[model samples]
Target chain A: MPKLIDFKLILTNIPDLLQYLPITLGIVLLSMVVGLVLALGIALVRLHKIPVLNQIFTVLVSFVRGTPLLVQLYLSYYGVPIALRYWNYYNHTNFNINHVPAFLFVFVAFAINEAAYNSENIRGALLSVDDGEIEAAETLGMTGWQILRRITIPEALVVALPTLGNQFISLIKGTSLAFVAGVIEMTAEGQIIAGRTFRYFEVYLSLAIIYWALTVITEILIRLIEKRINRFRVAQHLVGTPAPTETPIVGAQVLASKEVRS
Target chain B: MITIEHLAKKFDDHQIFSDINLEIQTGEIIGIIGPSGSGKSTLLRCLNLLETPDAGTITIDDQQIVAPHITKAQRLKFRQASTMVFQQFNLFRQKNAWENVAEGLITVKKIPKDEAKARALQELDRVGLAPYANFYPEQLSGGQKQRVAIARSLATDAKLLLLDEPTSALDLELVGEVLQTLKQVVLDHPNFTVILVSHELGFVQEVASRVLFFDDGRIQEAGTPDEVLVHPQHERTKQFLARFATQTVHN
Candidate 1:
């Protein structure tokens, strides 16, 4: 049997692949920011059940979520240019597809895909927030926007954070599909190097390791955020103190944030 | 003062309550006692426009709103005049006890953070939960959480405070503590009007200035606690009181 494994080649290719890491990370960050904003707007409309628009978004989100992401990428890659051409034709204006970057389609597709899934996660989190709390906020004379900002979003994000982290990790991996739209991200760079060297195993293995490392790092960051957000719970668990009944407040163990203390 | 006239609510075609009329005096603690599904909660919710009534006019303090046609500004003004304490003690999970009390003051009242914190701490002190000011609701008992909610309500200077089954969600052992807290709140603030919906007849009888026996979405009888609880007039009121009487005698 010929040498089936090449550890040295894998090590060499890893450094070469690392150069494109920024592109991969940039795509994930951009898509996540855009996707999260879209998802929140979609989820809010659904939660409020805004007549006809709510129904339309419900169908749109369902249709987006139900379809394969690869198909969506292909649709964007091929469809956007056509749609633009049609728009230009109708208005007798000049617009060109060649001026648009191919990577833009990939970004649009991934963001839409991420949004459809994340909106459900956010909506579930929103619903899980006790109705009683919202009622309390309302009766306190806070407007709907104020309640959403101060109570609903902060609390819902806490519940939705873990799932959102998972979505981001998946989104990072989802960026690999960008190669199909002719966007040379990390995986595409790997493919170009592999094609030249005929080192399929090492290149593919390096890609997998990069993605795994990204996911692990992202998960660790998410855990730290979760811990920070739930600091009171952590403190309670650490103290192991039984809840006191009718005890006069004596010493202050303040968790007061600067904003509150100010 | 709060006044409701010709209040009606319907779920699809089925009526929850219809043509309800009432005038609530300023500073009075009114107890609403009724059978389950008799629309007591619905009636309470309608007062604050939580559940939009199909037809009604609610006048709270200086603001008035016609049912189902309430403008956003009127709704906001009406809500500012009143606050509600939920049975489930709907404390904000993200907030510790003091933060829960301070939230409305800071956000709605536009009080400075330092002042809001002071007011929250004072309200918590009033409810005897000042020691647990930093504790989250999960770390507190049911009664303690309810007291925190009560503190939150008190932090806002709403003229009308609505208590919806305040003690019903508490454990048997914890009920007395919350009931005691509510009693103290009622006695201390005679100028703060309250509409209390409760299943605890004894607590209601003790704290309520007047009791309304509600049946079929209408006030069947309205009088002092002694009149409603001891010397009931309506047949439904008698039947409702008889169950409590049997339970009391059995105990």
Candidate 2:
């Protein structure tokens, strides 16, 4: 029988798989940027309850969240060419679907999926801001846009950072699924190496090790960012001295010495 | 001067206040005292156009805002002419004390950063909070936070200041510090108009030039502090004072 486990193969497979790491990281970074912009748009729509578009996005976000990401990936990979063909037929345009990169399909699917999840997180963070602070800003003559940019968004960002960091880590891992669309990332490369060598268990274990290392690195970076962002909160616990209890000011003796304003 | 005519507001079916008419002189410290839900806070909010009055004409200095017909520019102008200090302090949590004070000058007035910072520090100094200018709201005590809020309002250079239950949220011991700061503010800027809504009858009587007793969506009595607080004539006013009297004795 062939060796039950090719431990040596596992070690050798890692170097070849590392070459595809850039593709996976690139997808995560680009998708995160695009996903955040789209998520903010969706979050604001839901937050302000904009008329018809709100309802449309509400259903769209719901659909994306409810369906499996794998199914969405397949739909993006297969659905875009048909969509472009119809567009070209109706609009008399010569946009060739064949020229579109496979990575584009993978990117669209991942970005939309990420957006649906992050929009809720963003909306919750936005809502968590105190109404009193907004009112105070308005009273100070801050325009609606000024209040949003200066006060609301900054405050919401602090609340959203940790969850957003988690989302990014998940995105890094989720890039493994890019193989579903013909774009060979780290995991896909691992699969190819395994197929040629027939060291399936060893190759899969190496891929797991690579993913585990990526997750660990991502976690360390997120924690550092969280600490930096929460610098304001660090000194907060130092203060809370016990307040001296005095008589409630319901009706203390109206002091004769204090000149009554007339 | 500020003049209000036929000011009214309601939430769905409940009427907050209606047919309200009042006149306020520049430099006057007008105190409004009322029971909970008597619409005193809403009345203060309408002066700054924070809450739209269902029907009314409000004239603050030369700017006139006729409700239900206010343009965005008119509303902005009205808010710019006055500032408010909330009971909750409402200092921007992300910003330090100095930033909270400077934010209005920098953003609304469009002043240069260095000039705004200087003015903010000056305002903080006036409130005896210059030392704590670098502290965030979470790092300050309740009294300190309210003082920072007062500084922020003062820094805007608004002629009229609206304080809605400013000390209602403070600890009993902390209330004296905020009231003292307010008293000093009144003395320092005698020409700065203030409309204070509070349940602290003693503080109102001490600082208010005139007092209005509100009940059942109306100004039941408006007179000198002695007339309104000590020698109330209206039945509702007397009944309200009587409740406080009972509480004072119980405490």
Candidate 3:
């Protein structure tokens, strides 16, 4: 009789699955970079409520958010080649749809999916900045672009960072769907190894362990970054800091007497 | 010099102020006092085009802006002519005291970074905040934050300064430091026109060279503090001062 369980196969499957780890990470890294840029653009368009473009992007973001990632990957994978064929026929161009890489479709789908979710996170953060500070900046004669660059965006980033970090973790798990586009990432590699060995449970368990470890690492890195950026807040909680120079009691009384109406 | 004519504003159906007219001489400290919803703060905001008036024109120095038709250049020029201190002491939370003071200098005035830093330090020094230059808004007390805000406005070198209830958010004890700083600013820069809206009747009386009693979206009374705060000509002005009278005695 065949052995009931191949406990050793789980260990052996990890290194084999690890071979394709870079591909999975590559999709996440590239998509994160592209998605962040797209999200910022979408958030700004929505925040400012710019004309027709705002409505167009609003619907586009809704559709991406409402639909499943796998469906999105399938649509881009199958849809782009057909669209390209129609374009080549109409434009009288000789573009080759067959030469397009599978990973490009996966990258496009993941980035769009990430942008739709992250834009809301960014918009909330942008709105969270105090109106008072922006007014102060405006009163200082800073232009619209100057206020956004110097004051709004920097302040908004502090508010957005934690949510954006969570989005990144979700994006990592979302990249598992890359196999739907025919790209053999870690998940796809696990399935291939499972199919050959008929040890599906063991192979998947190893894959889960790797993904869990990756998530843990990402969380730690995000926390470190948060602590570093929030250093200015450290002084407020310190127990024994030196007091500020001005004597509050004396200052108040002198001001009241010297400047009072009576 | 500043001139306002037929100024008006409304939030939907609720009118904030309307058909307001006034002329302000250069180098004058103008105190505006009124009830809570009397549009005093909105009027100060309208002067710097912070609130876009629905109908009116504001002329500051050589630049003039008519409501609903303010050009970008006109708004920029008007803003450059004045700065504001908020009641909340709205210092940038992300920056230190010196950076807050230096921000307008570097970003708006396009001064060199080192020179801007020096000027910012000088302004902070004027407010007695030079030692706390590295402190963030959260690290400082309410009064210190306001002083940093004052330093920021002063460093811009705007001819006009608008203070909206500057000490209203401070602790009773902390109010004096901000009041002292404002008194010094007025004494040090006699040419800098200040438009202050405050419930601190005492400070307004001490610092304001001319006073305006704003109510129902109009200047109900305008004169020296003695005329409005002491010998008020309007019934509403007298009633307003009377309410403060009881509060002062209670304190």
- Candidate DockQ values, in order, are 0.49, 0.37, 0.41
For candidate 2, report its TM-score.
Answer: 0.91
For candidate 2, list the clashing residue pairs, or say none. none
lDDT by residue (B84-121, candidate 3, tens digit) is 99999888888888889999989988999999988998
How do the residues A18-126 of candidate 1 rate in per-residue lDDT, one tens digit apiece? 9999988888898899999999998999998999989988998999988988889899999999999999999998888899998799889988888889999999999
Comparing 2 with 3 on DockQ, the higher-scoring candidate is 3
TM-score of 1: 0.91
TM-score of chain B of each: 0.97, 0.98, 0.98
Cα lDDT tens digits, model 2, B58-117, are: 999998989878988888888999999999999998888889999999999999999998
The ten-residue window of minimal lDDT in model 1 chain A covers: A234-243
Q: Taking the tens digit of each residue's C-alpha lDDT, what string does model 1 give over B1-251?
A: 78899999999887988898999889898999999889999988888778878998988877888879888888887888888989899999888899999999999889999999999999998998787788777777888899999999998888788999998888789998898898899888889999999999988898889999998888899999999999998899999999878977897
Best model number under DockQ: 1
Provide the overall lDDT of each model, using Cα atoms, as 2-decimal numbers: 0.87, 0.89, 0.89
Tell how far residue A87 is off in model 1, in angstroms.
Answer: 2.5
